[model samples]
Target chain A: DAGITQSPRHKVTETGTPVTLRCHQTENHRYMYWYRQDPGHGLRLIHYSYGVKDTDKGEVSDGYSVSRSKTEDFLLTLESATSSQTSVYFCAISDLAGGPDTQYFGPGTRLTVL
Target chain B: AQTVTQSQPEMSVQEAETVTLSCTYDTSENNYYLFWYKQPPSRQMILVIRQEAYKQQNATENRFSVNFQKAAKSFSLKISDSQLGDTAMYFCAFMKHGNYGGSQGNLIFGKGTKLSVKP
Candidate 1:
């Protein structure tokens, strides 16, 4: 295990509500990523942070936002939940430590919007 | 842009038998990396193996090995002596090289193949 944990392992929220998921890592990795997994779509990147206060949009970042104020924590928030946003969200960390950029993942959070 | 494809939606193999999962990627860049990740029923994503495009030899980790045909844009995972523990959804991903500093470290993934290890 990579010492990564995701809070709120499962969540259900009604449409138009605000939802936030947290990813915490103990490894102090330099890179942290958020991805959403859906049937027939594999895992699509939502957002990622390279360091505290530095973030970038991924392939699917329309309804989501992310912020990292510290090395160990990265947060993903859905400003207004939508039914299409329902999926399993995963957090991953990578050190890029002179080897292949192998990313270790957290347990994941299942979020449903109705 | 890069794209990963896993043609097989589902596959099954008897315990102790060998099975291979197919993955193909399209990339114009010459330097990159390929990886296979396994997601068991518990939904924990585990890195199975990785191959660097610059390396000619395939990469292997215990019972899991990859066949890297760079020219053909193919990367396949072969599991020997498969066990029940191997039953899971396998994903193939691609990452371009030299994007270490910022947003480029993100990975592009395939739809995934479901492997069932039968008793």
Candidate 2:
């Protein structure tokens, strides 16, 4: 177990509404990542934080934003939800400080946008 | 730009049998890492095995092992003594080793292979 937890394991929202998912870690890991898993797409990186206040965009970052105000918390927000955004979101924390770090994932959040 | 490819979309194996899932990747970097992750019905990504590019020996974890061929840019996973609980969606992923301005620490994943272990 990586000591990671995600809030609101399942959520349903109407289109154009804003949704925010929280990722909290107890291990004080330096890196955190958010990904979405779809049927045909295994998992695509949405956003990742290397450290508090340092973030970067990922493969599928459109309509999504992330924040890392503290070492243990990373938040992912959907500016405006869309039906196409319905999918499973996952939060991961790297076990090490650098590259080739083995990422441990938390139980995903299932979101449905109507 | 690195991409991982898993040609087999679905695979089936009888209980107590062995199965190998093929994964081929394209990359220009010589130093990197290869990984295999399992996602079951629980929806959590579990790390099954990983292989370092510089390592000449294959990595093995109990019943899970990987055939890491750097020359061919192939990293295939072999599951021995497949069990019913081993059924899951297997994903092949790639990560660059150093921080050379590429997608380091970020994993590029293959679509996935749905494996079924039948009794």
Q: Give me the runs in candidate 1 sitting further than 4 Å from their true place.
A: none
Candidate 1 lands at a TM-score of 0.98
Worst 10 residues of 2 chain B by lDDT: B97-106
- Clashing residue pairs in candidate 1 are none
lDDT of 1 at A105: 93
| Candidate 1, CAPRI quality class derived from DockQ | high
Best by TM-score: 1
Off by over 4 Å in 2: A97-99, B100-102
lDDT digits (tens) for residues B28-64 of candidate 2: 9999989999999788899999899999999999999
Question: Model 1, B20-96: lDDT tens per residue?
Answer: 99999998999999999999999999999999999999999999999999999999999999999999999999988
TM-score of every model? 0.98, 0.97
| Fnat of each candidate | 0.81, 0.65
